[model samples]
Target chain A: MSMVGGRRSLVIPGEIIVEGNFRAGLNTYLENGKIYSTVMGLAEIRGRVVSVIPIKSYYIPKVGDIVIGIVTDNSPTYWQVDINSPYMAILQVSDALPRPIDPAKENIRKYFDVGDVLLAEIALFDKLRSPLLKANGRGQGKLKGGILVEVSPAKVPRLIGKRGSMINMLKKELGCQIIVGQNGRVWINSVNEKLIDLAVKAVKIVDEEAQTRGLTERVKKFILKGKEKIDLESA
Target chain B: MDEEIKLIDENGLRVDGRRFDELRPVRIEVGVLKNADGSALIVQGRTKILAAVYGPREIHPKHLSKPDRAVLRCRYHMAPFSVEDRKSPAPSRRETELSKVIREALEPAILLEKFPRTCIDVFVEVLEADGGTRCAGVTAASVALADAGIPMKDLVVGCAAGKVDGVVVVDLCDIEDKYGEVDVPVAYMPNKGLISLLQMDGILTMEEFEKALNLAIDGCKKIYEVQKAALKRKYDFTEKLKREADKSEE
Candidate 1:
């Protein structure tokens, strides 16, 4: 199969991405063995599969993916969570708490009220029903305190990087606790105020320059510069 | 009829100094509206239109939601000041008809099956309407849909061909359309080789109709290139910003 664009080259919808035998991946469709781009963004050809990473898009929920969501409304059994997708996710009371409580006896809003934020995993999702969320997973629960930063859902993968190298680097260098949601919401927790501010700025930079080369190196330098200022202030 | 004034001169040039088969200058800008999910502004000759696309989100009122595919909603509105006499701000009978036709023209290009139980709304506001507003609206709305990152099989483009003074021409101005023998506006998907919208406003001979259709499709093909360029222009800026930062660091 011959690819029309080079690796990581931008492509627009209806543009021919590849010809001959190739698997049509996300943001692409197969027509008579030729793969055509369905979105305007960078085309990624990995082995036999070709997908285009869209430049700007809404988050589509996938089962088992961790996401940060805000509580929009609450019912007796489930609390509606806005995961930045077109579909609203439902977080059941049974999945949120360690023990079950009677719906009529206890107030569900006290546990997860409107405007509250939580980190949860998509337990189930399909076209038939709204996405179901379970917050009982590791590091998944109601979020409070430090900083909250949001980037494009498309850039979430870039911020985390390959094998968590970029995020791991930030954790080690800045000593800040970070949780990245597949839905483009990020929670940054640090005792130092400067570090939290720096982390927020760092994440924003990553969002803007997600498609760039040498991004990890640039972010490392930025954190170092920020750390120096914090140390000087303390001294 | 005001037959005394000539739309086409004896030199074979039209009122705008364009040849009979020539198209009007076209320009398109993508992502013009920030609040809307996706937006675009298109200018074809003296016509100026702004289109916006929102959702693929949950359908309101609940019952309107489609089980198998997303419902496509479209609105085509002309501003009160768009015409010389100041058209009504309310939706006229003509506006309602244009909205439905434009929606049908664009619906084929969208891949609605991917987003079930949702609705995608497209609004095309004719900021300045010279003529052929419906066709131009279709062209601009497709760009807005792409900007919103809605997956589609292909991009949609629209253009018009009309006959003035018994001569066929591609892309008609307001004066030509008003006085022309026939006006044909066509919405086309170039890659798919499909005609989504074809409407004739006046009487035409079989021979004249065939010529007008071919000319309109040709016009659509040329405008399709402009649409693709407008979409790329947004992303190219992001790439350029990254490259400049890398250069400064070195």
Candidate 2:
């Protein structure tokens, strides 16, 4: 059955959401004037565009996206980084450094020690090749002294919000510096222990209610209440 | 077995009291396993199969990695205690052949080229087997793959039909499969109206064969409905929880 003009309708794999004159969006496919869901998700219709937001999925690497990765293995010229994706990515010394370094003179592992977390950009991505990482950009490179919180990759967009408004709110209200990676890793750095806990809870809420309408307002209320509770405890 | 024991009665109901066009009761549950990327359990009559999907991850034995498309691997295994008589734990030749066909049946529906140099593994374990385990396995694996959020053109549903007591039946149970004239199993993509798997054993007249094929396709369409419902049930629960969370903010 066609589900055109339906708002927030539940869809499963192989169910047709629209027939003809509509474009398929994320987690959907088009065939013979029909848009079919490729995953179990909530279908949304806006104008002539139809899309399904999958309830669960893993991160897929894309070029120019910033991701938090942990170094898994290191070579003389490159290191294998785990971005929590199905494929392991390679971070080359050339892309990570401003200038090429001689492997004979310097050890690559020294630059990115095994198990070290770092923020990097996907410099090159091909389906057949492991994603290549570059960490030379501003606010990139090694992450230091912060707890890493993992959320769903699909919710990352919501966590960042429109033009980074949600993230800015958290940073301003909580007095913390937060970096969200497209790969679903969030690094929270702050001096106040209670504030860090509150930030974590707020991010969790955003991830949980990412699909809900008016979520930005709800999350703002949730974080404010959490902050109030922390202040009351301190007093 | 008594030779006089009729497989079909004068009223045309089979041994299980189902009409020739009626199918055995089937139930599907998705996301049954916590660890697998995708999992589903399908109970079709007396047969039960659990299928799990993993990866689109890096391929082991690097030489097996395909540059243009992801490799598809399937393992169809029957547990030792699943049957009346205990079977061997080792993969049998029958299982190896069924695994290959199951892979071929599902490969076309998946968007493998989108993720190359990786492998998508589907493991189908027959927890119970009365008959038509291969067909049930294919159906369950397809659901598991979709549950894993692997992009696919359509869901593949499988069903079996056979001649029992000189009549074509929609789905053949264990007894009918053993004494039936012919058993034909088909894996079909309902939306695309394409057949991915077709296998027949025994004999049938051309007219009977055509009739059996039509019956199995009809059965597959019914099965397609069940698969969609199972997935919808899962996501509906998720939506409900999200709404509850939103309401709590008031």
lDDT of each: 0.90, 0.88
Off by over 4 Å in 2: A1-6, A25-27, A97-107, A192-195, A231-235, B1-6, B9-11, B237-239, B242-250
lDDT of each residue in B1-250, candidate 2, tens digit only: 5877688999998999999999889999999999998999999999999999998788899999989888999999999999989999999999999999999999989988877788999999999998888889989999999889887888999999999989999888888998888899999999889999999999899999999999999999999999988887765755677677799987
In candidate 1 chain B, what residue range of length 10 has the lowest lDDT sum? B236-245
Best lDDT among the predictions, by candidate number:
1
DockQ-based CAPRI category assigned to the predicted complex of candidate 1: medium
lDDT of 2 by residue, A115-186 (tens): 899999999887767889999999889998888999978889889889988888888888998999999999
Candidate 2 at A26: error in angstroms?
Answer: 4.4
Q: Pairing residues by index, what is the TM-score of model 2? A: 0.90
* RMSD score of candidate 2 (Å): 2.9
User: Chain A only: TM-score of every candidate?
Assistant: 0.90, 0.91
Across residues A164-227, which tens digit of lDDT does each residue of candidate 1 receive? 9899998999899999999999999988888899999999989887887889999999989988
Error of 2 at A224 (Å): 3.1
lDDT of 1 by residue, B1-250 (tens): 5667688899989989999888889999998998899999999999999999999888898899989999999999999989889898999999999999999999999999989999999999999988888889999999999999998889999999989988999899998888777899999999878999999988889999999999999999999999998888788746678678799999
